[model samples]
Target: MISYFNDYANLCFEKFGDRVKYWITFNNPWTHAKVWHSYNKTWRNKQQGMVGISLTSAWGEPVDLTSQKDIEAAERYVQFYLGWFANPIYSGDYPEVMKNYVGRKSAQQGLGMSRLPTFSVQEKSYIKGTSDFLGLSHFTTRYIIQKNYSALKGPSYHTDRDLVELVDPKWPDPGSKWLYSVPWGFRRLLNFIKTQYGNPLIYVTENGVSEKLQCIQLCDEWRIEYLKGYINEMLKDPLTTHMEMVTEIVVPTVFTLCILISAILLMFLLRKHN
Candidate 1:
């Protein structure tokens, strides 16, 4: 780690200098640490590994909009899931409130020094504005409530927050068993990024739902519906379409049936004309 840092830092100043404006040292270290490392000890220690801190932004929607308890719980769930990693990258530290609420035993066992890693003075300075653009990978948001810790079992980070997540049965489950439609969470996440990081350039890196099965047809009405809602919400904020060309770009997909129809038509016309 030390050698890599020294090498990169030296290389940056010597060769790249002003040419290299952004540096993303790590991406998705949460899944890397929790899932990969937790699963196997040897795999965790392997060197020459790319340790990105890219994490799933588990946005939560309040089941009851008017209820203050539900509102607070929704906010708490956001802090526990999304804010846990995003806060550190932009702000240079973990959300202290989260650490306190997670309880002592959690600190000792699964997340010893916090699942969110700490940064040194030098590291923070390097990382703070390191991103030329913020990247967000999202799927669906879970609904959460402040349930007592007794309900949860296992030494997992989910239990640490003392909050339980629930998915609305109404949400159409296409692929993954866990994901549910919580459209508002996308808007909230976008707003949070704009407000927190001085409204830095953002790239919605991964923002679509999956059907998992290959047998699913290309006429994906559900995916179309998901994209339309989320994109419309995103468009509501003008700042999202700032001094950047990214938002303007849209690549249309060629449906499989359309391709097949075109091929068949071409063949039929060629034979008839010939």
Candidate 2:
């Protein structure tokens, strides 16, 4: 599977390297990531373009701040979702919390060793220092709590994490039932990426809200306000350094996006200046 990615990216570099200056190796690390490996070895010396990968995660807020377990649960959620992929590329191995918890769960399930897999010392050396930048996609926030349920009896990825995710009912609902506007989570996730990944060159590969398709309203006031809140947060925060771009996409019925079009241009300028 990885070999296929390696072949395709080499073709891309050979064909389009002169045009495409920035390259993202994969959408998520659970998928292909050979471009960074390939580019650094072969194409990068000639192409001179940067290569990185994209990750998506939600900010997990502790359900009970005073509870140490809940605090760790919140941190663990990010590590499992974001750090599971990013940590290996940045630090050359899985997060220690993930190793300990998953390994313990695997043992309880009667496995001789962790089902999560481990890398060789040489493999770690190869994987380390592979990426030049980091791309991330984030939306919303979830309240996390220690899992105390029978779900842990299984050995899937979620069960091993031993955490329950929830949300605040009072959060603002834009247009989609699933997506609530949580601007604060955006900053939290960004800061986490900065600290966890040594403040690498950051690009918000995807960031936006969804509106229900039942109404084809051209003047999307809710979306405008949502962008204002989220983009303003990124502008003021000093933690999210080297931010390249905040990409967005909206799904709806055929309608001229006169309002969102204007909002997007304004956001581009704001992002450029900020």
Candidate 3:
């Protein structure tokens, strides 16, 4: 498997060269690091970040903003769920805060290091800001609670954040397991990226709803609504307007008007002759 992946990476570089500036080698390895690695050791390594892992974040909300525990847990959840992958990808480092919470037993057994991969000094420079545009795939986030360390399952990498996650009972469900109606998280995440990652170019890669068996085909009203809400938030970002080009919209309108006036004048002259 490692050989095949190495060969594939070589093939991509050989064929694409520097032309393919934006390359997504891997995405959402956390889900695999959790479920697959739990069952099979071989599968875990096979599925690990051979290229890189996308820290696909389900940006959760705090149940009680006023409560210190809730706020800390919410931040922890963000760090564990999002920071776990992002920290390594950008800074080539793991969330040390996560290591402390993941507990001792699991840490010794390799579950802690199992999920997070360390980069070589060379790999660190290669992976940092490798993306020409950061494409984010987000849906909904869980509201987190600080549960007892014993109450948590698996390893330190999993529970180091000291947060247990659940869907907001009050938030309207979009029918998927980890998804709920939370557009604010999307905005918050964008702002976080801009602030943390020096405002790189961003593209909303996957933002949608699970309609379930309620409908056969994809009408996607929920997706449309989600985009509208989040896009409005993105526009509010101070950097968003920098890319806003007046030339593209205005040039076409001006050209069309000039053509229409010329055509109208030509027609009027022909009509007078008739």
TM-score of each: 0.62, 0.82, 0.64
lDDT of 3 by residue, 98-175 (tens): 655554435655553544455578765644543434557887867777766652355554544667787767776666
Deviation (Å) of 10 in candidate 3:
2.9
Q: Which pairs of residues clash in candidate 2, taking residues 3 or more apart in a chain or in different chains?
A: none
Tens digit per residue, CA lDDT, model 2, 48-134: 899888888889999999999999999999999998988888898999999988898888888899987798998677787777888
Collision count for each candidate, in order: 9, 0, 1
TM-score (C-alpha) between model 1 and the true structure: 0.62
Q: Tell me, by lDDT, which candidate is best.
A: 2
Candidate 2 regions with alpha-carbon error over 4 angstroms: 31-33, 150-152, 240-274
Error in Å for residue 163 of model 2: 1.3
User: Given candidate 3, what's the lDDT at residue 21?
Assistant: 37
Where's the lowest-lDDT run of ten residues in candidate 1? Answer: 31-40
List candidate 1 segments past 4 Å from native. 5-25, 30-55, 103-127, 150-155, 212-217, 238-274
